[model samples]
Structures are given as structure tokens and as C-alpha cells.
Target: MDILHIVGQQRLEGTVSISGSKQSAIPCLAAALLTDQTVVLEGVPEIGDVATMIEILETLGAVVTRQGDMVTIDPSRVESMPLTGAETRKLRGSIYLMSVLAARFKQGVVGLPGGYAIGPRPIDLHIKALERLGVSVRNEQGVHYMRVDRLVGNRIYLDLPSFGATISALLVAVFAEGTTVIENAAYDPEVIDVSTMLTNMGASVKGAGTDEIRIKGVSQLSGCRHTLIPDRMEAGTFLTMGAALGRVTVDNVIPLHLESVIQKLERYGALIEATDDSVTATFQEAKPVDIRVFHYGGFPSDLQPVISAALLQAKGASIVVDKLYPQRFRHVQELRRLNARITHEDASIIIRGGETLLGTEIEAPDPRGGAALVLAGLLASGETTLHHAEVLDQSYERFDQKLKELGALVWRETI
Candidate 1:
């Protein structure tokens, strides 16, 4: 295992370019398997989850090559096979392989996925959506075996707007026989990026950033080069870090995707300047503000932890209501370990600021939560040692290096 040694009480300053979206890269890589030709993906982050996905692809006979931030995959010789149970249980996103393989081949098998144990996240939505597309799915002792003679597209009305299910549906629907309409689909920006990649590859997909997504299956998809969109969550995390610590300019990010986060930070007394593709966040001092979070098109649930960090140093109490992912407050315990005064009741967290935080040993519960802990560590007093720091690698690219460049005393050490 590896631990991160972080020296606290340092003001962060520097311009850091955000990495590509890990959420977008995973499904896009799986989408490449639908085509026999080589697909060149630029700006792909070199992260643990992505590396695992690439390894899964290689095990299925896809010739994959990596050069810096670029990944090239040739799936001409790829075959459908069951992913190893161990590998499948490593990351939740690995379950997406089921839809891709099932769409490409007549039969596919994969075990249940596992990632950070924040709460129970079942794949029933995925299975239900797959069944709607004519795929017969069966689960035996935690392993999912699926078979589909032919995929004939049909209207799929998701019970809830799930990002994973929407992406999985898009992956399989791109190669199906007829038009597939996904009603009440997730309209996340990552979904838009995947739909854009598919459209470039001759797959007719429209209404990606809306509730209704329509996919017109093409007979064959040609290989095409595509660059992934900037990671909004990564951009938001740094923005929140700047709000908590000091004035920091984050470059190479799309400003529009961060509108909700930037607005929330602005409400919390952070100065934000947005350009076409970059956002600069500067904090003079922490000011107290009331934050009310709603559903999508409002404050997102992913930024809740870092937002809570910002509120920790504020002048008054800040109320955060997470309409989505009510159980995402696992980071609150870790924040409390650093001396933050936070009280949680139901789906809301009330933060009372003006409390000085002292660093201590803590563990990251998940990727975003790990990021919030790192931000808290950077702003706390004394040294903070973070165990299981590898969890941060699941998303952020060169996270420690970026933090170090911003004058943070953070280093990775093996234990």
C-alpha cells in the first residue's frame, strides 16, 4: 500500500491544467471495441481505472498502445470473453464492459463491480436497460452472464436518470439494428462527450445533453480520432481548493461545464473569472454564506465535499442539501478528523466555521472524497498523513505533482 505525506498550513498558488475526464474515457474506450479499425483517443489521462480498462481490453485481444496522454486501440482481433472476477471487482465502471461486449458479441460474461464502498450502488438499472434492448441477463453467485442473439432497438424509459445506465445504453444502442430512444436519460456532460464521439464514428446519436437521447444505429462504424472533454469534477475540485486555501488559476478547462460549481463558490465569497475554456478562482478570505443545493441544473452532488471544505473556514454556518447521493457525506467524518465542525442530519450537512483544523491521519472513502481530504490537508495546521492515497489516482492525473506545483508539501510514499 502507499500513503501520502502531506505537510499542512501552506497556501496553494499556481496554474494547473486539468486532466481529461476519466468518466468519459472509460466508455469511449469501450465504444472503440464496437469498431474493427483503430481509434486514436487524445488527452486520455493515465489513471489506475483507465489502465485497468485497457488491460481488460487487451485480455479480450484488442491491440492497445499508450503514448503519454494518447491511447490508440485496434479492436480488429478482439473477442468476447468473461472478465476476471478480481478485475471486475476493482472498479465500478468495469461493469460497463458488459454492455459493450454484449452488443459486440452474441454472449458476454462479467462479475459484479466494486469500487469505493460509500454505499450500495446496484447494477440493476444496467441489467434492466439491457433487458429492454433484448439482451437476456442472468446473475449467478455475483457473476452476470448475458446473451443476445440480435439487438433490436426499442424505447427505453429509465426509472431514474442514472449516468452509468445511460452510458451503457448508449454503448449498446450505437450498434443495434434500429433506432433506440432513451427517455429520461442522464444529461451529464460526460454523456454528451460520449455521444459526440459516437456521432463522429458514424453512429447517429442526438439529444445527448438532454433528457431524451435518440440513437440511430449504423451498419458499421469507422475509426475516428477524438479528444475527450475536460473533466468538470476535477476542475471543480481545484476551484473549491482555491476557495478554501488561496488564489489559484486553473487552466485548460471548459468554463461552461463548471457554471454550477463556480456559482456556488461565488456565493461563498470566492472571486471567479470565466473565459471561454478556463476559469480563475481567487479567494481573499473566507466569508460566511448560506448554500442551498437542489437537483441537477443546480449544485451537483459530486462537489459537495469540497464545498463543505470551503464552508469549514467560513464566517457563519452554511447549509448544504444534497438532493442526489444522500450518502455522499462519508467525507464528513474525515473532515471532522481534521477538526472541522460539521453536523449532518439526513440529506443536509450544516457547517459551522471559524474552527482551526489540525492535521491527523485519515483514509479516503472514495475518489472525490479523497480529493476533499487532500484539499483539507493542504489547508490544515501541522502534518497530515493520508492512508490509501491511491484512491485519488482513480480520477485526477498527476494529482500530487499538481498540488506540489501549487506550493503544497505533498509526497507519495510506499508503506
Candidate 2:
């Protein structure tokens, strides 16, 4: 494993280009399994999660080749083998293979998904949605086995607006025989991105970016070239860092996807300006603000910890709450090591601002939690040794390189 070596109190200012959306890229990668023709994906971020997905694709005998950020996947020789081993457990998106495999092969076997131990994600929705589509699903020990005598389209009403469930239903429904309607679907931009790509691949999908989605089943899908949407999480990270440090400009970001975060940062005392594809953040005196995480069109739950950490220097107290994952306060203890006054009360993290953070060695709990530690490290007094920081690469593409580009004194070394 590698650790991030950071010299604190060095301002990271300048422009940083946001990479491809990790949320969008993975599903689009999984969608390739539905076709035998070649699928070319541009702007795919070079991140750990994407790498793991590509590795799984290769393990299934998909001929995958890469050139810079562009990935060409030919599933012509792919097999619906049982998904197991370290690769499956390394990424939570491994379960996404279930839909495409079930659609194309009528049977699929996969191990349970793995990701940050923040909280229990409702994967039952995925199984339930598949079952509603006339698929037989059962779990033996931990591995899931799914099979269908015949593919038939059916209506699926998600209990929650889960992004995974909506996309899973869409993937399987595309190959079914009849029309399928999804109610209370997730409204994330990634859902729209996946639908866009699936449409390009000759699938008929409608109302992707809404609570209700209608999918007319097609006999087969062909591959096409699709460019992924810009990553909003990575874009929000730059804005958070800029608010904590100095002026920063994040390019290649879609302002509409980050509307809630942009508004919140403005309230928390960061001078923000946005054009079509760029957002510039300038440091201002920190101010206390309350943030509540909701689904898309709301404050992103993924950035809860990072934003909480950035607000540590605010003039007053601030509250960061996540209804989606209350246990996300795992970073609270790590932040306290740097003299941060924070309290975890159930679903909320109360941050007491105005305390000078002292640099020291710290361990990251998860990806976003690690991001919180990174911001705290940059704000600390001296050098901060960040251990177990490799988890940050799971979502952040070339993190240390991007920081160095922005003039931050940061580097990575093997532990």
C-alpha cells in the first residue's frame, strides 16, 4: 500500500481539470456486456474502481484495450462466468454485472458486493427488481445466483430512489420482451448518462432523469461510441479544497450536476463563479452552515465528510448530517486527532470551528473519509503523514498528481 506525504499550510491554487464520472463510467462499462460488438468509451477516468471493472471484463474474456482515457471493449468473445475472487470483492460495482449477465445469458452467478463500511446499502432492491422481471434469484451463503426461464418486462417500483436499483432495472429491462416502467427511480445525472449511452447502443430508454422511467424492450443492442459525463464528486472536491486553502478553478465540470453543492459553498463563505464547463472558487472567511444530504438535486451524501472537514475553520459551529449513511462520521475521530472539535451525535456531525489544526500522522477510514483527512492535512500546521491513503485512488483519479499540479506540497510513497 502507499501513503500520502503532505506538507501542510501550503496553498494549492490554480486550475484542476475534473475527470470522468466514476458513477457513470462503471455502469456504462457494465452495459457493454449486453452486446457482442465493440463499445468505445471516451473520457473514462483512470481510477481504481474503473480499473477493477475493466479487470472483471477481461476476466470474462472481453477483449478490452485502452488508449489514454479512451477504452475500447469488445465483448464478442466474452463469457458469463461466475464472478468471484479478490476483484469482485474489491469493488461494490461488481454486482452491476448481475444485470447484464442475467440479460444476455439468462443466468449469472456473482459474489456479494464490497465497498466502504459506511452503512448497509439496500441491495435487496436490486434482487427484488430482477425478481419482478421474472428472474429466479437466490443466495447461497454469500454468492448470488440468478436465472430466468424467459425474459419478460414488468413494472418495478423502487422503495427508494436508489441509483443502483434504477440502473439495474434499466439494464435488464432493455432485453426483456415487453415494456417496463420504473417508478420512483433515481434522478442522478449518472442515470441520465447511462441512458444516453444505452440509447446510442440502440436501446430504447425514456425518462431517465426523472422519478419515473419507461423502457421499451428490444431484442438486442449494438455497441457505439460514448463519452462519459464529467465527475461531480471530483469537481466538488476541488471547490472544497479551494475554500479551505486558496483560489482554485475546476474545469470540465457540468455546473447543473453540482447545483446544490455550489449553493452550499456560497453560503459557507466561498466566492464562487461558474460558467458552462468551469467553476472558480476563491477563499473567503469561513462561515458556519448546515448541510443535509439527500438524493440527486440535493446535497451529495458522498461529499459530506470532505465538506465537514473544510468547515473546521469557520467562524462558528456547523452541522453536517447524512440521512443516507449516518455512520459516515467515521472521519470524526480522525479529525479530532488534529485538534478538531467535532462530535458525532447519531446521524449528525457537529463541527466546532476556529481551532487551529495541528499536523500529525493519521489513518483514512474510507475514500470520502480519507478525503476529509486530506483536507485536514492541508490545513494542519506542519507535515501530516496520511496512512492507508490508497483508498482515495478508488474514486479520485491521479489525486496526488492533481494536487501537485495545483501547487500543493503532496506526494505518495509506498508503505
Candidate 3:
């Protein structure tokens, strides 16, 4: 097993580059399955989720090649392979491939959605959207079997603005017979990113990053080269690290995409300077603040764990609430193991500031939990050993290495 040995009380300085968006890359790769040409993607981060998507594509007969940050996916020789239960069960993103396969081959069999158990992410919305697009969806055991001869586009009103359901709607609607309208859609930037790529590939998409989206089906889509947006989630984590422990300049990021996180950091007495492409943060005496996570354009639930970890040094009490993931207090438990004063109440995490955290052996429950544990380690004075650190590779690209580049004392060990 892989573990992280972090020597605490060491401040970080210098610059760190953010990687590509994992959110955009997954749907874009699924879009590639709609075409027969070679779809080239630039700035695709090398993460475990992406690697799993690539492996899934290859199993379905897509030719994939990777050179650094560029990925070339050729679906010219694609076939309808029975996506085994063990295969699609690797990650929740694998669920998107089900619609892509059904759209291409008229039928598909994929296992149920699986991945980080951060919250209740039911796939009922995905199935509902697919069925609305004229696809007959059935569940036998834990696998979903979808078959559709012709996808008839229609109006889809989602109960909630789910990111996965929005992507699935776009996937099935692109090759549909007529126009498809998605109301109460996800307003995330990744939705716009996927829409832009689909438009470049000869599909008609409009009103992305809004409550409503319109998609006009095309006869066929050709492959096109697309560039991914920066990973704001990764950028936010690094920014929290800088404001909590040391000074760090995070580069290769989109400032507007991080407005929510930046505002919170600045309110916490961190000196923040953001340009068009980078943000530099300097830590000072912290001021406690309440953090509430909502949908896009609001504080992201994904950053709740890491930001809560940073609030430990504040002078007073801080409340971190993630309504989207009520059980996201796994990091709070791990931080308590290191002698931090924190409590979880339903969807809220109450953090008592000014606690001297001591380093000890801990484990990460998930990817973002791993980031929070690492941040807690930075506040500790001794050696902090973090097991199951491999979960960090799921979303973050060279995270510990980036911290090391910014002068953090960290080492990766196999024990």
C-alpha cells in the first residue's frame, strides 16, 4: 500500500501549476465514442479516473494514445462490447459510457454506478434522462441494459441540477432525431466545456452553464481537437494549503472559475492577489467564517473538506456545511484523531479554532478526504503518516510532489 509521510510545521513557498479538469475530460471522452474520427484532447490530466475511462474505451475497441497532456482517442473501430459488471463498477463516470454505447450500437450493458461514497449519488436521474430520450432502460441484478433503435428528442425536466445527468442528457441527445431541451440543468463550467467540445465536433449545443440547455441532434459528428479547462478543484485545494500554512502562487488556473473559493480565502485574512491566469496567497492570523456549500456559482461541496481543515487555525468557531454531502464529516473524524477540536452535526461540521494538532497515523476515506488529512498534517508538529494515500491520485495530479516543489516536507513510501 502507498502512504504519505509528511513532516509538519514546514511552510510552503513558490508556484504550483494546476492540471486539467477531470469533470470535462470524462464527458469529452464519452463524446469521442459518437464519432469515427480521431478526437484529440489537450491538457487532459493524468489521473486515476481518466485512466479508468481510457481503459473502458479501449475495451470497447477505441484506439487510444497518450503523450504527456495530449490524448488521442479513435473510435473508428468501435464495437458494442458487453461492459462487464467488474468494468463499469470501477468508477461512477463509467455510467456515462452506457448512454454513449447505446447511442452508437443501439444497445449497451453496463454495471451500476460505483465510486467514492461521498454522498447519495443515485443513478435514477441518469436512467430517467435516458428513458426520456426514447431509450428503454432496464435493470437486471446490478447491471443496466439499455436499448434504443432511434433516440427521439424531447423536453427533460430534471428534479435537481445533477452534473452526471446533464452529461448523460447531452450524450443521448446529440445523436437524437430532433431538438432536446434540458430544463433546470447543471450550471457548472464543465457543462459549458462539454458543450463547446460537442459544438466543435459538429453538434448543435446552446445555453450551457445555465438553468436550461438546448441540443439539436445531428446525423453524424466528426472528431475534433479540444482543450480542457483548468481543474478548479485542484487549484482550490492548493490555495487553501497556501493560506493555511505558507505562501503559494498557483498558476495555470482560470480565476473566474474559482471566485467562490477565492472569496472565502480572502475573508479568512489571507492576502490574495489574483490575475487572469494565476493566484498568489499569503497566510496571516486567521478569522473564522461560515462556509455553506451549494450548487455551481456557490461554494462547491467538493472543497468543503479541505477548506474545513484550514479553518482550524482561526481564532473562533467556524461552521462548514455541505448540504449536498451530509456525511462528508469523515475528514472531521480523522482530524479529531490528530487532537483537533471539531464536531459533526447532521450536514454541518463545527470547527473549534486555535487547537494545536499533533501528527499521528491516519487514513484517507476518499480523494478530497485525503487532501484534508494532508492539510491537517501541515498543522501538526511531528511526523504524520497517511495511509490509503493512493486515493489522492484519483483527482489530484502530482499533489504531494507539487507541495514538495512549493517547499513542503513530504515523502511517499510503500509499506
Query: Global lDDT of each model?
Result: 0.86, 0.91, 0.91
Worst 10 residues of 1 by lDDT: 288-297
RMSD for each of the candidates? 1.6, 0.9, 0.9
lDDT of 1 at 171: 86
- lDDT per residue for candidate 1 within 1-415, as digits (tens), equals 6799889888888888988888899999989998899999998999988998898889889999999999999999999888866777887888888988888886898988887665557789899889888889999998889999888899999888888999999988987888999999999888999999988889999899999999987778889999998888888998888877887788889888888888878877888887887888888678766655544577777778778777888868888887566788889999999999989998788899989989999998888888888888877889998888988888889999999898888999987
Candidate 2 per-residue C-alpha lDDT over 193-312 given as tens digits, one digit per residue, 9 for 90 to 100: 999999998999999899999999999999899999999999998889997799999999999998998999999889999998999888887899999999999899899999998999
lDDT of 1: 0.86
* Model 2 stretches with alpha carbons more than 4 Å out: none
| Superposition TM-score, candidate 1 onto the true structure | 0.96
The lDDT ranking, best first, is 2, 3, 1
Q: Give RMSD (Å) of candidate 2 vs. truth.
A: 0.9
